[model samples]
Target: SILSIGWAQWILSDLPQDSLSLAMTHPEMDWPTAHAACPVLALAGDETLAGCVPARRRRQLRRARQAASRCGRIALLSASGSPQTFLDQLIRLHNMRWAEQGGGVLANAAVEQFHRLSLPLLDAHGLVRCWLFAIDGGTVGAYYGFHHRGRAYAYLGGFDPAYAEESPGAILIGHAIAEAIREDAREFDFLRGQEAYKYGWGAVDRWTMRRVWTRS
Candidate 1:
C-alpha cells in the first residue's frame, strides 16, 4: 500500500491507465476521504498592499495596526541565514496560542526537527519566506511559509494570543501578503483551511486532496 498527501489538485485524469490501477483500489473513496478546502488570495501584478484586502477588512487592519502600535514600537523583520531564533520564537508563540486547543501543529519535537533540517536548504534556494513581528524588541508574531514560481504559500504562523485584541496574526499575515505582492507572487495561498479570517483577507477556496493506494 502507498499513500500520498497534500496534492494541490486532482491528477486521476492525467494518470496512465496502468498506473491508475496501482494508485488506488477505490478511487472515489480515496479522493474525497482526506480532501480539504484551501483559501488562496489572488494577487494582481499592480495592487497596493491596501488593495489586497476588502474595504471592511482594510478598516479592521488599520485598527489592528493602531492597537499593536500602542503596545510598543512595532517592527516586522525578515529571517535570513540561520533562522533558529525565528523558529524558536515562532514555536513558543504558536504553542502558547493554541495551548488551550490541545496544542499547535508544531508542538512535536519531530516536527520541529523537520523544520530545522529543511528550512536552511529551502532558504538557500530562496524559497523560504519567514518574518518575525516584534514590539519594542520583543517578538510577538511569526510567519513561516514558502514562495516559489509566483506563488507564496502561507504554511504556518503563530502570534502571542495575549495581544489578540491587536490582531497580531492578522497583522503578520497582512504584511506577508504585501511582501508576496512585492515579490511578484501571483497568488498568496493560505494552505488548507476554511478559517473565516482567511476570507477576510480576500482569499477564496481552493481544494486539495490526499489519496491512498492498496495492492489489488
Candidate 2:
C-alpha cells in the first residue's frame, strides 16, 4: 500500500533539515490544501472511511445538519460582522445557565493560523463565503460559512482559544448569521454542535443517509 503523501515524504527526505514538502510549492491550490497530503491507504473495497464511531465519543460523530433550519421562534438580525453586543449576550446566556456549559464562546478570536487552514476549504468550494470577527485588533474568530441552495452552511471554523473564556466560537456563528442575512440567504447554519446554545439559536439535527460498499 502506498500513501501519496508518504511517497513524497520518502522521496524528498534528503532535503535540508529545515526543509518542507515539495507539494507546498503548488500554486493552483491554497497553502492549506497545497500541503495537505496526509498518509492513508484506502483499501480497494473502501468507498468512504467506513468505520463505526462509538456514540459516547461525541466529537467523532458524523454530522450534516441545517443549523438555521426552520425549527424555532428564531430572532433574526442582520449584519456583515457580528457586533460585540451579541458575543456578550451569548456568554451571559451560557453563564446564567451553568447546565449550558460549552454552549457559547465569549472571547475567542482568530489569527492567521486559522485562515491558513480555511483557505483550502474555500478553494475546494469556489463559492464558500467567509467572515472574520476581530476583537481588539486580533482576529478572535472566523466563520467559514457555505452558501448553497437557499441556505448558508457554517461548515469549518476556528477561534482563539486564549479567549475561550469569552466564547469566541459564539461570535463566529453570530457573524455567520449576519453574513447570511446580508446575502439574503435562507438560513445560517452552526453545522454541528451538541451544545444547548445552538438550540436556543434554533439548531436542529439532520441525519444523512450514507451508502457502504463491499467487495466480493
Candidate 3:
C-alpha cells in the first residue's frame, strides 16, 4: 500500500510519551495560503541577501607612509589582522581608562550578563555574526562584527565615548572594507541604519523588503 501524507499540524492531544512528542507542538498551515505565501519561515536559501566578510588582515603603517610620499594619500593593506580579537582585548583596557576617568566600575555582574546572554546571540549565526565589547582604546575602538561565512554582515559596533572625537566608527568601517574584499563576498551589507557613519563610509540606501505569507 502506498500512502502519501502531507503533514501540517501535530496531534497535540495524542502527543507520544517518548521523545517523539517533543516536536508535536507544531504549527498549522492552510494549504491554499501556504502555496501562495512568500514569507520568512518559508523563503528559500538567501542567494542574494547573504554577504561574506573577508579575513582579518594587517595594515602596514610604513606602506601608508611610503604611499603618502607618491599619492595624495597612501593606503595600507594587511592580511594578518584580527580586528575582532584586537577589539575584545581593547575593551578591557579601555574599561580601566574609564575607571580612571570616573566612568564607574565595570561591574563584574554586568560583564557576566554580556558574556552569557548578549554574546550568545551575536555568535549564534553560522553565516553572519558580531562581536560585543566593553569599551575602546585610544586608536583602535572596541568594535564587533567578528566572524561570518557566506554573506557576513557587520551587525553592530561601539567605541569609547571619549574617542568620539576621533570617529572610531569610521576607522572600524574603513578596515572592514578591506576585510570584505578579502572574503570575496558578493555584497557588504550594513544591516539597518541611516546614520552619518553609514554615509561616511559611502554606503548607499538599500531596503530590506518584507513579504507577508499566510495559510488559508
Lowest-scoring 10 consecutive residues by lDDT in candidate 3? Answer: 34-43
Q: What tens-digit string does per-residue lDDT give for candidate 3 at 58-126?
A: 133223233333423322222123434543544554564466565423335576456445554444543
Which lDDT tens digits does candidate 2 get at residues 1-216? Answer: 433333222222222223454334433323221221111111111212122112322122122012212221223232123334333433343334343455333223453335445445554565566555455444545555567765777654455555555555564564455455556565455554455555544455442222212222
lDDT of each: 0.80, 0.41, 0.39
Q: What's the best-to-worst order under TM-score? A: 1, 3, 2
Give candidate 1 misplaced runs (Cα > 4 Å).
Answer: 1-34, 45-47, 209-216
Task: List model 1 lDDT by residue over 28-88, tens digit each.
Answer: 3344233578788888644456656787887888899999999999998998776787789
The candidate, 1 or 2, that scores higher on TM-score is 1
The positional error of residue 176 in candidate 1, measured at the CA in angstroms, is 0.6
lDDT, ranked from best to worst: 1, 2, 3
lDDT of 3: 0.39
TM-scores of all models?
A: 0.81, 0.40, 0.41
TM-score of candidate 3 versus the correct structure, residues matched by position: 0.41
Model 1 RMSD, rounded to 1 decimal: 5.9
> How many steric clashes between backbone atoms does each model show?
0, 13, 13
The best candidate by TM-score is 1
